[model samples]
Target: MINEIQHTAETKMQKSLDVLRDNLAKVRTGRAHTGLLDQVEVEYYGSMVSVSQVASITLLDARTIGVKPFESKMAAVIEKAIRNSNLGLNPAAMGDLIRVPMPMLTEERRKDLIKVVRGEVEDGRVVVRNVRRDANNDLKRLLKDKEISEDEARRGEEGIQKLTDKYIAEIDKMLATKEADLMAI
Candidate 1:
């Protein structure tokens, strides 16, 4: 049972790290990436579908995103979706393709993005800590129920703390990378 609790905590902690990675990916770093539009959904035939479904998004250059709808008629729809996605992006309709240019980040904007990244990292830290707390609680419960000896409970708690430290370090590494990316000109 202690092993089970440890496994669950590790799984939850890994999930938190994955969330941090995905959130960081969506944060703009003055580069054009297809992941930037992964959250955008376009209206296609009365159904809300991802931009990738209705269009092929590619990076035309370091700062330009190229989106080509499968159907020429869907170009306007895809462009409109990008405009309304609240991502602060403007897509220009160029014949059958839509070009979304990633604007350069101002110094102030870069600072602001850094704060956002920091907040995400903090949240990731919280998630890992919470997992640790839950695992510790499970150990306590097992001890209370007399299902595990006091020594076993102590070892289990130590194991959980080790897992917490490992995951928190992972989050810190990811945050450092993201901060460097945001601060880079």
Candidate 2:
């Protein structure tokens, strides 16, 4: 029972870390990458689909992303989708290709982005802490039911704490790297 609780908590923590990573990726720096448009959705034949499904995304340069839809007619829709995705990007339709340029981050915008990243990191920490709390509670309940000894419960709690610390450290490292990326010219 103790092992199950610990394993479940660890899995939940790992998933939270993965979500945090995805969120951080969405917060773009000055550099451009195809992943930046991963969340963009476009209307396709009366249904909405991701930009990648209807078009191909590639990095034209360090600061520009090139998206070319399979059908030339879809280019306008893809450009509109990217513009409205609220990533603060401007995609111009140049014939069959849509060029999305990542604007340079100003000092103020960089500071704002850091604040946003810090908020995301804090949310990640909260999720990990919540998992730890729930696992500890499960251990206590097991102890109360006489299924686990007090010593065993204590050990399980320690193990859970170690997992929490490890995940939190990884989250912090991601934040530090993102901050450096944002600050770099």
Candidate 3:
């Protein structure tokens, strides 16, 4: 039972790390990547769909993202969607391809992004700590119910703490990398 609790707690911690990774990916730097437009939605037929569904996104260069729509007519709609999205991108249509260039980040913008990254790191840490708390609570409950020995509960809590520390270290590493990316010219 103690092993089961540790395994579940570790799994939850890993998932929290993944969520932090996806959230960090959304915080773009000056460099261009296909993930930047992952959230842009366009009207396809009668339903709204992601830009990636109706168009193929590629990195044209370090600073430019190339989006090619499958159908020629969808170029206009895709361009409009990218423009209207809150990514602060400007997509210019040159024939069938839409060129979305990533603007250079100013000092103020970089600082703002750093602040956002810090907030995300803090949130990640909180989630990991919460998982630890839940696991410890479960351990206590098991001990009180006479299901797990006191020593087993103590060991389980220690294991959960170690997992929390490991995940928090990973989160801190991610923050450092992101901060460096943001600060880069």
* Candidate topping lDDT: 2
List model 1 lDDT by residue over 60-175, tens digit each: 99999999989999888888888998888999998998999988889999999999999999999999999999999999999999999999999999999999999898888998
Error of 2 at 112 (Å): 0.9
In the range 1-185, model 2's lDDT, one tens digit per residue, is 88899999999999999999999998989999899988999888899889999999999999999999999999988888899998999999999999999988899999999999999999999999999999999999999999999999999999999999999999999999999999999
Q: What is the lDDT of candidate 1?
A: 0.91
Residue-level error in angstroms, candidate 1, position 82? 1.4
Ranking by TM-score: 3, 2, 1
lDDT (Cα, 0-100) at 13 in candidate 3? 92
- Stretches off by above 4 angstroms in model 3 are none
Residue-pair clashes per candidate: 0, 0, 0
- Lowest-sum lDDT 10-residue window in model 1: 42-51
Q: Candidate 2's C-alpha lDDT?
A: 0.95
